[model samples]
Target: MKVLLTGATGFIGSKLLPVLTQEKYDVYTIGRSNLDYAKHTKLDLKDNFAIENLMQSLKPDICLNLAWFVKHKIYWNSDENLDCLSLSTKLMKEFYKNNPNGIFYGFGTFYQYLHDTHIGNNLYTKSKIKTYEILKDFASLSNYKTSWGFIHNVYGKGEPSEKIISYLITKLRNKEEVFVQNPFNKFDFINVVDIANQIFYAIKNNYIGDFDICYGTSFTTQEIAYMICDILNVSKDLIKINHQSDQKFEISSKPLDIYKNINIKDRLCEMIDNL
Candidate 1:
């Protein structure tokens, strides 16, 4: 299968590339920077004409859309979210136009769920929800086979320093105080490698529709912090938990058991030791 991947240099995509290659798929990547492992095309996703032209030429059997504006706290309200949403939708349309029988897989977020309480309401979340809806609707109209994977917190080595896991790991390694504002906030963290494997599994099985790419487990901020502290043999007292901040809970739909063999604590330990 000829696979086209966006966000090839990202935290998840970087890990996913090897998995696809190991499966012997002819992979092509699009990114701002050139990827060393595969046939990479350096192109800006925001340019519709360039994207359409590339899609027409490649006509890949599968397109995995993972590109987005993912700057830490700023992405919640950044206008780049809207721009990414538009670009992603345009890419999907072009992909369909070129390869009618091609499969398209989109990465979604847990924040897309509409809860009565506006805990996760933000520009980034809203953009993801809107983008997924638009793409899914378009696929339906065209009778295209599409899969939407709603992901939770994905953590691994080589993540940006601004990410939660990276931040915690740094502080813990330095024996510095880790201040967590919303200690009660619950999250489900899946290893990036596990996420990549699940994506491969879904595509291989020809599964379609919405699925949650997360380990069927959730943890509070304090619990996760202490787990890191325990692994690093650091003082648990260094973790300061403030209960005043708004606590967000991410609920998954159709959670998968693909990551049952992996232990979260062991993963944290390995990441910390590597740092």
Candidate 2:
């Protein structure tokens, strides 16, 4: 089947690309930078006309959207969240217009399930919720076999350099003193590979609607810092662990589900060594 992938160069998308290709699904990627693969288009996803033109060209059987305004700490209140939502809506419409019975999968976030108090307080969360609702509503009325994957605290290869794991790796490699903040905030992190695997499993098994994409485990920032220290065989004394609230929030204290089939511990050495 022809598959159109948005955010193919991103943390999660990059991981999923190989999985899809290995499974032999005809894949087309979208990005501003030229992709290594031949079947890709570099254009503005916000441009409705561009989407129409591209959809007319590929007419994919499935569209997996992993793009969004995720600029680390800045995305929570960014106006770009609205733009992503708009782009997603346009893509869905164009996809349906081209292949009426095709599949359209998008990524949601754990923030969408946070207490109602966070709704008006976060544009990123609010925008994602809006997109999720739109997909569900459209799917109910049309033949778009859409699915929404809710994920949070993702880490792995190709992740942003500022991410916790990446940060620790860089600092430890440089022998710089690293500070562990939000010592009590237990965040569950899913590997990009695992997230990609889950997405494929959902599509292959015909799983529809919304579902949580959790690693089924959690570790505190301090714990994670030490994990890196151990992996690097560096002195933990070079790290400072503080109890102060880091203000970095996560979805919950424990995973909503315990899907620890893939261990982050097993993957860390390879990811760190490679990066």
Best by lDDT, which number? 1
Clashes of each: 0, 0
Leading candidate by TM-score: 1
Report the C-alpha lDDT of model 2 over 1-275, residue by residue, as the tens digit: 89999999887888889999999999999866677888888887777888899999899999999988787889889999999999989889899899988888889887676637433369888899899889889878865688888886788877778888899889987889998876766667777777888788877776777777877667778878888888888998878877564454545432323354657777778778789
* Candidate 1 residue-wise lDDT, 35-131, digit = tens: 7764999987778889989999999999999999887677888999999899889888898899999999999887776434465578888889888
**What Cα-based lDDT does every candidate model obtain?**
0.84, 0.81
Output the lDDT of residue 163, model 1. 80
Q: Which residue pairs of candidate 1 clash?
A: none
